[model samples]
Target chain A: MKDETDIQTPDEALEMAKKSRAAAADAGKKPLVYHLALPAIVGCLIASFALRDGLQLAVTAATMALLALVLWRVRKRGVWVGNLRGAVSYLLASLLIVLTLAAMFAIFWLKRTYGLDWPAAAIGAALFPVMVAMSLVWEKLRHRDLTGKMS
Target chain B: MTNPANGLEPLFNAPTRLQITAFLSGVAEAEFAVLRDMAGVSDSVLSKQLSALSDVGLVELRKSKLDGRQRTWAALTRKGRKSFAAHVAALQQLVQMAARAAE
Candidate 1:
């Protein structure tokens, strides 16, 4: 029996990882489903109504679909498999959030600067999904850290 | 240090397991191949260590068939991650204590 502190070779490491995966599979008893999907669908529907418009509808739908895709992929392919890709994807998503905020902030600043009042609906349509998506991703990541689940 | 959950030494307390956990703890999840490469141990040896950690509920394992072959992945449980953090804290303390004694 290998005691604790035993040095492992490359092959051993792979075997250990294999065993770890098997152990996790054996332990997990819950029927896997989209844990956040129903709530997300509901939230998206509410936002669609609030920010109803062609462009708003399109953008919001796309963003929600993208989020759903990510969650689905993460579920199908274990978090370990997409670890590097996931980091990159999250980084890109965060950048999108930053862009959304900057754009909204700019709109408000321009309105104040030029004595123009742009419609909140227009801004809301564009900004709402960005903020929602960002918060959703952040919440997922935080939950993973808190619960050790692969979001 | 002893594990409060099971009255055993923490997984990361063992140098080899510590090194393995240290490597896996940072990344989201690690494949058996990646861990094997990083730990620099034989397959059988690594399997034994992982078994010990799994038995203690500090780590988790999942295996699936990919391309009609088996692929294995490992992740730290919440308890395991917390324990790793605690072990690190303990190690830092030990180091500080040793430094003070040397001084």
Candidate 2:
């Protein structure tokens, strides 16, 4: 097996070493996805609580999954005590989306079963997917840069 | 055996040093704890390697204090960065040459 140590050159090796350090520091910053998605996540939790009987648990699971995904991303691509972190971010993110959908479903169930009005539920429902999709796209674009300092 | 491609080898060939360099390469500067974690090495081992790299003028170590605790940060000197860039280029060249030879 080819280990990183087997690679050659005094200078190139040094560059990789330095890049690893910068990568660590940059990884410390939370992804933009997390920041933007926070509001939608909060909305989901709120809606889930109001409609707990139907989809609350599922929504809650989705939120947990999303959080786990973000952390996974940090662990995988993000720097850990030097190269130990693997790439579990994608899986975690998927969990979050599922959680969000669950919450939306709960709201749907509530509107149908209860007398909840259309406008509020419609607005909340619309916001969740848009926010999640935007967050995903933003992270994909930002992470392409190795430094993780997009700006 | 040597790399037959460009007659050049990777610099900072050692594991510890490579970890250190990789960590430093991404940052403007880094403290001891930072590098320690990045390299996944003990204090003493990392310290020894840093000392050697510093001796070669490849790294610059500056000491300061954080909340009354002494702090040491490491950075690559200009010569060090240049050397690293050249080393990487050489390795790439070697890889390319080797590929061509195989073909």
Candidate 1 residue-wise lDDT, A1-151, digit = tens:
3365566433344345444433333222122333344334434543443343686588577768867775555544433422322474578566865765665566557556874444333554555455556555644553344334221
True contacts kept of 1: 0.18
Best-matching candidate per lDDT: 2
Q: Name the regions of candidate 2 deviating beyond 4 angstroms.
A: A1-22, A28-151, B1-11
Shift in Å, residue A13, candidate 1:
18
Q: Model 2, range A48-123, lDDT digits (tens) per residue?
A: 6544465768887897787766555544432332211214445545666776676667666767788574533455
Decoy 2 TM-score against native: 0.45
Q: Candidate 1: where are CA atoms >4 Å away? A: A1-151, B1-8
After TM-score superposition, what is the CA distance of residue B8 in candidate 1 from its true location, in Å?
9.7
RMSD of each: 11.6, 11.7
Per residue, candidate 2 scores C-alpha lDDT tens digits across B68-96 of 66778788777676665555555555656
lDDT of 1 at A137: 60
